[model samples]
Target: MTGPAQNALYAALFGDPQTEALFSAQAELAAMARVEAALAVAQSQLGVIPADAGPAIAAACTALPIDPQDLTQATAQNGVPVPGLIAAIRDRMGRTPHAAHLHWGATSQDIMDSALALRIGPILALWEGRLHAILTRLAGLAADHADLPMAARTYGQAATPTGFGAVVAGWGWPLLDQVQAMPALRDRVLRVSLSGAAGTLSAMGPQGPAVRQAMARALDLGDPERSWHSDRSGPGHLADWIAGLAAALGKLAEDLLLMTQSGIGTVVIAGGGASSTMPQKRNPVGPSAMVALARHAMGLAATFRAAGLHRQQRDGAAWFTEWLTLPPLCIAGGALLRTADDVLERLTPDAGAMARDLQIGQGTIHAEALTFALTEHTALDRATAAARVADLCAQALREGRDLTELARGAWPGPDWPALIRARSLGQAPQEARAFDRAVRAASGGLDQGGS
Candidate 1:
């Protein structure tokens, strides 16, 4: 799973290597050990476990001198790794009373859950940085292309004129919202889990709440008011948020695929895929990877919903199912975010091709503009005037004369220059700049300040 040829995804295109390593077997074990150490210290502070035992146990977890192969074998036998991990740490400590106090009050779920939260906090921060980069790049694109005209389409046919910057803003806002939401999402999802045996921390006595709170402080995680042994809301929301983000990126990828097509060519991507046999084909490879990853996330979101159906307090079946679902979701999300940022950096909109697309309708593209201009002289309302001008433009296309020529013949007062030039960019430039301002606000104006 680590190498390119073996797993391909974690090493190749679909997973970020840094984030991938964060969820690796060694990382997971180490994190679990950290959680165990924190629990020991927290128990010692509350007088639930001996003070001398806490230092030795914490040191063992910190050093992680236990062998990986032994832990793996024990995990297979015990159905979870913490029992084996604890045995190894205790054996390494080598004393009856000192080793006896190791992991006195915590359960396997507590270690695993808290360890996952520890890993996730860092992962979410990684995404926040990546998302900030995206917002910065997108804002620049919006501002630079605020006036760049492109033919707008409805139902895959030319509808009117619009600026590409405005379209980019639509993409920017969803990502902005996601970025804005990260802090709260992390707070909610990265809570420390310290419930023992069952939902209640019965083994830790009445100081259970304080010990849990102390552990939360030790790990820099949110201290839940109650143990979330059965409550899957936090993890579910994180998955949903990531899935929504991937879905938004998928929308962008869909447009990128369409705009980069052979005939359309409204977009130019720097690094595209090559066809094996067809030397002329340069495929939209990045967006294609994005589409595949997004689809994977969307599909996993459904499985997560089913996985969250915990059968009462602590369904080992349901919890194990999450083990199968969430890590891949994280991998896909991390990879997609990176790919999207790269795609944005490498993408170039073909201003010339966009202008040419406007001409494909052969002046019929300006019918809406013409129709509005005709409203001044004629007694016709907008709909009637639009239909009247549309007819002339359609007939002109068939007869090979210009729309302006036909419009002047029929309506007499239409302003040819103003009407034919792309119109109704109404508020588009302002909207683009507004998105830039929002980015500045999020970054505390540092990203584009004094520029």
Candidate 2:
């Protein structure tokens, strides 16, 4: 095979085909070819190179028939792919004058960086749509389960009761943050790089800025005004987005893993992993993969962070580190979001299971609500706690009795039933509705030709 299967058995579980293509050698070569063509055109328009050579240069950039094996061998010597690619284009151009202008006044970094911007533009856009869809799905779930009462756990123990919709909202809100943050991040990272040799654009003269602007316009990328030869902060923003996304999805994965535990059984997912030996096992296959990908991405993102420390005007170490790290990150980002979306689509909440879990603590989960009721009736001295209500709640839990019954015995007039009722998801239902409303507004904005 020319490359790894984009969606082989293992890959399909944690890879995105569209994004995988974006980082392919063919895609990289094609992007660089387009940048070279556009560079020739821009230079031609400025009366720099022969205008007649522009079309020929563009024609030579056509992909296919060019072997990646050849480029790989050439790259070993040249330290970059453009020199090999330019040589191939020139050879394909058949000793014509147009071949002379194939990469006029441009360095390998210029071609590669500009091509990366050209490629990343669409990649960012794809993620935007994906994130928006995930958010929309989460918002719908939140609205549908606004009153779903589930035991909210803290430090791995049931602390209180909360709406499952609120839990879904917790998974979603960070993604909305990412969705809301994408435009700015795109502007930061998808910038055209046209500073030749050492970022001075000394070869292009006074027209360098104009050519950069023209190329940015042609490639549909942002122009960074100054050249970013060693300034990788642009791509760093992309790393932040990728890492932030993984962390958010990791949270979702954690919750799903916990909720689908054999004992909890609160989350019901389709296509769970089956055991080879143990027929009783229905493993959470998708959540496990997504969580693994997220953790892997977190480590890779740290590489990008460490990559920020470049040496001098250019550091081969950092640049090469990015080459090693960034592409996988983009791929993982696509995969995580796609898997999370699928996980949500097939996910169902076992309401009965959640209610049953609330009983496991034998009414100790209602201690907070009981405390509030107690506080409502009378004020307590700062040190009045230890032996009084604590013993009652502990006794209730140990004896498999209801704390509400004990509280009712004590207060006599406090509406004890209301305190333990599922209806007391204080402000959770309203927050769920608010998220639903926000999603609707964003959708409407989209329909009305806004972001």
Candidate 3:
């Protein structure tokens, strides 16, 4: 019911404690202070500010010399928290000669955006770690179940027989792509923003480019080489990537939901939610949460992309829209990944249940395999074989008998049981092992070390 990761009621369900702290108000204040300190140092080194002022500001920032509560009212009046933060830093260094050089020529957007990059550095690392963990688990699952036969469903109906490993591979392939894209995303999105008042370093004069590059070095971020005050592509790209990751997790959740349905219990998730009145209920709570979180991230991502319409040099309305949406979108993505890792760790496939569902419609699941066998092993043409197979499938359904049993009466040439077993899992095992191989190649090994 509540918004924001700090919501006491839904924090655990929809927010990741670690990532939430990274986006908290106090953390934001500290990050902005770090940006200010780094900017002062960079400008001082470039002879744009007093050298003593740089060291003094750095010391004040290291001390984090301000109360976050004091900025609430000031931020309401100033429209951005950077001004309040700067004023607080000045107050903390009263009577100090170097305090005058605290902010130097940098603008509010520079500090805030650079601070966001600072916090995002560690957040990206955390997300990559979680992503690698999930991939490792999925690779194991695929390898183990590569030969385990199960019915593959399409449009809510059994379409063909596939190994459970192939099903697992389907869930992990997109994740593999996400992990691979992390390096580029980090490089492009995590950069310094050092534009002056109007996308030009007019205040810093001729030394602006050097100052920005020095600040980038001081803060361990990439130099954008130009102002991004009016260009929201970095944030837009970040939102798109987060939404994509959420969608991947959502697909996995949806599949788990169907697999755990009552009549088709192919997967059993541990620690499912219990019904208040129903005694024998084990609800798929984790998967359900992931699905909901994915939807939330998707909606926020659309809004964030729309907010990229930065008008002229700057647009307060569009900027404020990002402030409203980006934090929750990031939180939702983190929570989805956390939930997926937990769900995968606790998941157990029910081979018996899968086998039972494979024959749900009187062995009609083998219709494709039967048709293929007739053409390949006998003199029957493709059309004749298909029609004959369809006819036998109808007879088996009408009489409530196995299709293979009826096929024996129709075609006695091919070894029916062997043919069914051979064709039931066409390339499914290969597909699963191929995924495992890819994970191993990408990760160096399956030891869950790094991405």
Off by over 4 Å in 2: 1-7, 378-387, 420-423, 448-451
Model 3: ten consecutive residues of lowest lDDT: 442-451
lDDT of candidate 1?
A: 0.83
Writing each residue's lDDT as its tens digit, candidate 1 over 7-84 gives 755446776776777878888889999998888888887788877777778887886876678788888787788899
Instruction: Please give, for residues 1-451, the per-residue lDDT of candidate 3 as tens digits.
Output: 1474568887778889888888888889989999998999888888898877788888888868577888989888988999899888888888888888888878898898999999988988889889988999999999999999999988988888999999999999999999888878988888999989899899999999999999999889999899999899998989999999988999999999999999999999989999999989999999999999999999999999999999999899999999988888888989999999999999989999989989898888888988888888899999999898899888998999999999887777667978989878999999999999998898873255543
Candidate 3 segments whose C-alpha is farther than 4 A from its true place: 1-5, 445-451
Ranked candidates, highest lDDT first: 3, 1, 2
TM-score for each model? 0.94, 0.95, 0.97
Decoy 3 TM-score against native: 0.97
What's the TM for model 2?
Answer: 0.95
Number of the predicted model whose lDDT against the real structure is largest: 3
Task: Please state the error at residue 449 of candidate 2 in Å.
Answer: 4.6
